[model samples]
Target: MKYQDSLQQASDKAAQVKLFLQRTNLAAHPINYAVSYEYISGYNSELCHIIEHKLLAKAPLDDFVMAELYIRFLAPANPQQEQLLQEASSMVSRMAAYSDVAAEQLDNYIQQLDSSMLQIKNLGADTPLLNIVNQLQHSTTEFRLSQQQMQQQLLLANQQSHQLRHELEQLKQQRLLDPLTGLYNRLAMQNQLDIWFSEQPGRRIAAIAVDLDHFSRFNLEYGNTIGDVILSKVARKVSSYVQNSGLPVRSGGEEFLILLPDVDLRSASEIAEQVRRGVEKLRFVSSRTKKTLPKVTISLGVSLYQQTENWYQFLGRTAEVLLLAKQRGRNQVANETMLAT
Candidate 1:
């Protein structure tokens, strides 16, 4: 049954990829083919959704965008790579076990030889000295062989361990990244915050909470496909602002969060306003109809972390400020500074 299910999934994915390629009019180039395959496979849902949106809208998948998407999704592990990783891991485990057993046996043999020597010495050199010496020589040869084997195993294990660690780090990075906008995801955001807090308990961590203004209305007017394209573009714009000094996170849906460590509230708010203007200035046009999209805007809420506050409280306060921004008017930055005034 599992085999049958796997076969069905493969068939479906192949069909989807073929359809996508036809729709996009993409040539069967290696990069194009690989990108199409990944999209249909649904391994990277975010990437798939964005590409599907573009294809449906007949948007130009230019070299630059295609290259970015390929680098984001196709740069990670595939089945063949994963299988090889598993095999390498198994080999390392087996080698470690073999090394442990070999060392233990060698130690036991050394102890037995020591006992034999002690017995001989206690017996005033009359307790079958020839046999004891012969036994000792044989044990010494076996022990040397065991030591050589153990050393070889240790060398191989070290090499494999290094390779495995590299692969694992790549996997970790891939997992932490958001497939849609090529920004860090929520998990990565939290992990980064924890690291910053641990390093400096009183670090000035500021957050910007971003929400698309009337996203539902936009999606309704332009359809979900166009909506996704807008979201991706907006996220990219937002990410560009803080890429150098902070973490840009696609918190969820059409919302984003930017974490700026060692930044004051004023700096964070300025960054948030920059992101807002960047998003506001974007003009999207459908490649199919050449129809210009409605102007998009985002509401931003910025807040600084309080020493006495927890992460949730800090986040909630930012969220509250964002709500105020939306309530006051969209496409504006709201912060504690504004609230105090």
Candidate 2:
């Protein structure tokens, strides 16, 4: 639609130029020169319209206007070298004729004027024409300054826009992160797991529910503040496990969840057992305690996320298995269903 409008505008401008030339007195040299300029402007505008349609169709307003300005400034090039040579020859001939007429007219005007009138016309940098010329020079200088200032303003605005985009992305990451544990929080998991589950079908999935074994003991033995430190330690260990396996998320206080994307019950159980044993062997040394702390363990339950399973069912099943693991022993792994012989 915009291209069509540009074409119509070009056509209308051409028609206007034709009408103007037809009414003007071509016997006058200035009028003929003006007509020639009009033709050149129209031809250049046609090319500008074509380029605008191709390269700058979706470009912003400033870009489009700048492109047109550049095109209008340089409009006399011919694609054919021979044609360009001929056009140059014709231009030279026309310019020579105009120059000759201009020189003759200037000589005549000078001869007709007296010394005083000639001095006024010459007006060496201090008369009315000189003052007008000075004002033009000043205005051009001021215009250039204004353009430079505007360009600086645009650059600053662009930098600010880029910074704002970066900060927005950072804010999104912060929202998905667990500040205390330096792990993905529940909100992140909800989105990540949903996308992962949708991509795979008719495949075995494993959800491992994890909880710190006797976590309250830390608060009882040391303090609530110390318990938080233990939680952070536990979170680090789970994150390490996820780096080796998949992603681990801190669901809430003292609780974490691991997702094994394509693992069946047996494979999931082995992974769960490894995590439990890994925690049991871990020795946490604190700033207060010179010696390594005593045994640490976590109970785990592994379950598959079925195609028909919703987020609620998958999580609920894993939670149920976790309860079974806790009841069976303090540190053990339980599966979604008992293995068949």
Best by TM-score: 1
TM accuracy, model 2:
0.53
Q: Tens-digit lDDT track for model 2 on 174-228?
A: 7567778888765577677677657864656678889888887867887788778
Q: Each model's TM-score, in the order given?
A: 0.54, 0.53
Q: Please give the CA lDDT of all the candidate structures.
A: 0.77, 0.63
For model 1, what is the C-alpha lDDT against the true structure? 0.77
Q: Write the per-residue lDDT of candidate 1 for residues 1-341, one digit (tens) a residue.
A: 21233767878877887887787676767787778777666667878777665554443564445655676556656446767766766776666577667667766867787687667666676557867776887877787787777767776776676677667667768867878777787557767878888999888988999999999899997899888888998988988888566998877567888999898888888888888889989999998799998899999999898988666566767777888899897889999777766
> Candidate 1: where are CA atoms >4 Å away?
1-167
Cα RMSDs, all models:
13.0, 29.9
**Model 1 TM-score (2 dp):** 0.54
